[model samples]
Target: MKDTDESIELSKRMIQTGELCGKTTTAFITRMDHPIGNAVGNWLEVLECINVMKSGKGPKDLVNLCLVQAAQMLIQCGAVPSGTLKEGIIMARENLSNGKAYGKFREMVVSQGGDLRCIDKPEDYPRAQFKADVIATSKGFISDINALEIGHIGVMIGAGRNCSEDAIDATAGIWFHRKVGDRVEASDAIATVYTEREETLNSAADSVFQAFSFSEVPVEPEPLITNFVTKDGVSNFSMSIFED
Candidate 1:
């Protein structure tokens, strides 16, 4: 809801049309609080998703975000009870941990003619020819990571395509080493940039570093979930719950 006009309008239109979402079919609405995980680019996202599926432990915030979204999706679809969110989370975790999630991913890959070798051994997937770590300059908490600028860095590195005609390098991306509310030192690795080409590495490094902000004061990160908009009304999450 914070990002797209079309999404807001689509929800409104659905309600106006006949309350099809909440009444006929359940609709779960949520927005990404950050880049959505530890990975901030194309191939990086794929690898991150796979790691989460295989291990059930990658980034805590990402794992929970996915589990919460899945739980809510099940509840709204009536497959799970409204009171069973916690249980639903457990179920989702089981699916992720027990190879159920990877099975679906593999099926999709085969359907699309993607290399089975990569799916079987994703660690052997294409890696950046060059890599660099972005280290923090001070001892403090990560106050912010600019989501948009980080995305632009991916585009600059060719992980993201500028237009439909622009070819994207599936191997290029950045991996977050620290996130908001996390502590860091004078030289803690906050992120890693990956790309095959050296031409864009330096500038991309600058953008990646500039994208983060640090502070000595403690920081309370924004909620991954802001609210739930349903047929009845919006149920807002209290921001006070996170305040220090």
Candidate 2:
């Protein structure tokens, strides 16, 4: 068989094995084409997630995107009522707003022997002393943010590791001041990168600039949820899935 055919057959075999083992496999898809948020290090990422939950304000696109994927997965797995998906989202939003999500996150952190105090004071977390801003060159709305590029920038800046032995700065990361649909002016600071080393910060800043794009006209809001799929078939249950 050809290389592509062999590869396809191997994947099918793996899927069959998974099904035989009574394990359900579902794919959740979304694009973070831009940086996920302000945090990068493992601990710092957790802290950022906690802050998101506490503030009840997350990247609206990111949260809704994940929920739409998850709800579809649940329906595929026969885990919950299709009509309850909206309720699930409302519950999730409320949980985050009421700090329940943050509390749960803290419990997980403490259980794992991580320092919990940093959650309250992100500044207490070690920070990359050097920083720089990425300025927009044109006036327009941010049309796209590339996730992979941002991740690459993080690795270049010491926020992530290139090799298994490489060290990651827990506090190093890029922060975005702008999101999709937000208007930006020329020379406006769109994002900031933090790094322990000056050289690394410069490299990261360059990557950040390359990762962003702007258009004169605003881009249509991308649906947080795309198409929901089940064993039976695909469903266009975007808003309905959330109507609890």
Q: Which candidate leads in lDDT? A: 1
Over 30-57, each residue of candidate 1 has an lDDT whose tens digit, in order, gives 5554666788777788888887887778
lDDT of 2 by residue, 1-244 (tens): 2243453445456556666788754332233444555555565566667667778776766566555554545555666555466655665666667887778878988999987787767767676688899999889988888777777787887778889999877767777888767799999998888878787777778888888878889786555434433333344435444444
Q: State in Å the error of residue 115, model 2.
A: 2.1
The lDDT of model 2 is 0.67
Q: Model 1, stretches more than 4 Å misplaced?
A: 1-10, 14-33, 81-83, 238-244
Weakest lDDT window of 10 consecutive positions for candidate 2: 225-234
| lDDT (C-alpha, whole model) for all candidates | 0.76, 0.67
Q: Scored by Cα lDDT, where does model 1 land?
A: 0.76
What residue pairs clash in candidate 1, if any at all? Answer: none
Runs off by more than 4 Å, candidate 2: 1-19, 23-25, 38-44, 66-83, 224-244
